[model samples]
Target: MKFNRRTFIKRLFIAAASIETFFLIKGSISKTHLEKDKKELFNAGKADSFEKNKPYPFLTGQFFLRRFDDGGFIAMSIKCTHLGCIVQSNIKTGGFNCPCHASQFNRFGEVLSSPATRPLDYFPITIKNGDILVDTSKPTKRKSFSKSQLTYV
Candidate 1:
């Protein structure tokens, strides 16, 4: 076996290609496993942790957890109903403002202004041992807010 420059170059290229392929395959496998076990349950901390009349963003800014003055908790989806853009909370206006289309929604997920035909979406909330659990898997779309939409702890 004579050591040649051509042979050395070929072997080095093969080794580098093999290493790159291995890493690509490994990363894809890990990503598939993570996607398989994707969970939508979000812990909003204790039921009492929320402040009254204030909105708290949770689960990577996916939803807003608001504690009403009447001691009720509601999880409103941040996604705008019009174009699916994330809405920002406007405390001064007491509503949510969508930067994409200028759609406005009240604190209860009702449409305050248009371009948005329907109101904002909401997630179901459960109180277990004082811990607030929000189910992002189940989303409810409504035109108005009702007593059933609120979760009283």
Candidate 2:
């Protein structure tokens, strides 16, 4: 094998460049998972509480608010886990169904079928400053879920 200084330096440079590029891609993927989508076109407290009988997706929060049997509400996530597409609430059916793949989730964000193994990602809610606030930053651990977890408008 013939060894030359120029060839040795070229091989070393190529190896270093490839390693740097791999690290850069890894960092970007990690950040995308952490960062929530900023296109929160809807703000909380934007819509007046309407009668449950009306068909309306609540403003600010994700899904439409419905009066449960216990008189509580559940705020379901609008983004579908399957493909990040927005899921629509089938008011007539009384649950949210993803139009993309027909993945159905109950108002409580439960997985109603096979395509989606996990339920809808929930947003934490707290009443602050006389308005219902939804913090979309950190996701919480999944526990025994009930439709009651959905926040009402």
Candidate 3:
């Protein structure tokens, strides 16, 4: 059982690889459990808190709450359609700008510039007991903005 330099290096490499593999598997298993335990619907907040025709960003939820002038609500995903980059809301421009690719989207989630051929994805909104809940589990993709997509009170 004499330990040579070559043997030590080989054993070290094997141990490192095993440790890496174990961490990878553990991370994936934990992620799966987290996904399973996550709630499908997110309680945004009281309906009154959102102003009309304004976009409220939910950074943690990865979506934006848009209240239309007609008292309609839309839960739009911040992810850009062009390359899945998180879009930044530009208050001055009244649109979203993707830092990764510069794709622009209007407040309605409509693509105002190129590179993003489709509009931003959105979640379904449900008003329950004066609270606005967004179904984050399922995100619907749209080619363009439509009046029917608005969830009115």
Candidate 4:
């Protein structure tokens, strides 16, 4: 193969484009499957182990788990739906609030203020074998909850 600047650049561009396309497709597919396979691939950190009387650290996202007064579990995302900034969790308020613009989300990820067109995203969680697993990658329309994903004793 004879070396040429134009040919090298063309090949490089093609490679980069192909790689980007592959990743984009992969990401889309995963998002579609977010709800289906969340429980399977979450062995490393299960979401079902979280207890009812405890609020647990979530997978790197805008949510945490806490037992509701009625003895059920609520997983709330801390991400601001307005700008994607991490929502601040207030132990005093017992809810997640966005400091970036003062957006407030209830225990169930509902928006309590304006400037947020959509509600805070919630993940389907479950507890299995004493760990907590949350599907932080995508938010599903119908949510599931389990404390088996948190890797806490």
Candidate 5:
């Protein structure tokens, strides 16, 4: 049990390596947990909160929640398919207009003009206990709007 320079240096190096290894593993585990936690579903409030045939803009979430007359909901992304510009909602027309390239989209996100060949992207909507939840993590891109895209309550 004699204290020697070589032994002390070796033990210190081993301890330092062990600590670094532990930290690296811990960081990776925490990152993975955070990714799992970030499912990122935007809660759009109660189902009854949104009026029929009206577009509710969630700026922070970057999506528009459009409620149809038949209790159907469609969450469309605000990012314009043409050059990724943020589309502005035309309340009077109940459609979307892109300021960047003058791309127009109808209420159903269908493309009305050029510069954009596809319709506006949309997120998946889920109804839980009368609440509207839009999955903003990933948007579904489509060439046109269809009845299947609408979520009915």
Candidate 6:
């Protein structure tokens, strides 16, 4: 076969396209596997370690574990409902602030300001052998706080 410029360019394009497609498929497959292998439940820590009226931000997991004055515990997601940006806890304001869109939410996850039409998402909490376990995989979105959402030790 005689080597031509047109043929060489066509072959190069084909090889480049093939390589790109392969990488995209490989990345998607790996992402799927990672999602499947993710842990559903995370151990927050011992029940005693949490202090009343304090919010413990789990930065790695993007959630907050708070203890109320009544000895009640609640686990809430940090992702803002408005734009999915991480909400930061403002202890001075006793609420959460979404730096992305300025959406505000109270410590109870109730929406105190606009932009975020709904409250922050919360994960169910379970105590097993005195260890507080939070189900990070499943999150419940609510507009108001409920008695059932609180877990008492």
Best by TM-score: 5
Could you estimate the TM-score for every candidate?
0.72, 0.55, 0.73, 0.54, 0.76, 0.74
The C-alpha stretches of model 6 lying farther than 4 A from their native spots are: 1-39
TM-score of 3: 0.73
lDDT per residue for candidate 2 within 14-130, as digits (tens), equals 999999999999999888866655423234563245344333465446544444554444455677777867888777767678888889877666778647667777656654454
* Best candidate (score: lDDT): 5
TM-score sort, best first: 5, 6, 3, 1, 2, 4
Task: Provide the RMSD of all predictions against the true structure, rounded to 1 decimal.
Answer: 6.0, 6.1, 6.5, 8.4, 3.6, 5.5
Q: Residue 85 of candidate 6: its Cα lDDT?
A: 95
Residue 150 local lDDT, model 6: 92
Which runs of model 3 end up more than 4 angstroms from their true locations?
Answer: 1-39
Candidate 4, residue 57: CA error in Å?
A: 3.4
- What does candidate 5's lDDT look like per residue over 73-143, in tens digits? 99999999989999999988899999998999999999998798899999999999999989898789998
**Candidate 2 — what's its lDDT?**
0.62
Worst 10 residues of 2 by lDDT: 39-48
For candidate 1, the lDDT comes to 0.88
As for candidate 5, its clashing pairs are none
Which residue pairs does candidate 1 place in steric collision? Answer: none
What's model 4's lDDT at 92?
68
**What TM-score does structure 5 among the candidates reach?**
0.76
Assess each prediction's global lDDT (C-alpha) against the native: 0.88, 0.62, 0.89, 0.61, 0.92, 0.90
Clash statistics: count for each candidate: 0, 6, 0, 40, 0, 0
Q: What is the per-residue lDDT of model 1 for residues 1-153, given as tens digits with 9 covering 90 to 100?
A: 899999999999999999999999999999998876665778889998788888898747389999998999999999999989999999897789999999998878889889998888999888989998888876788878897888998
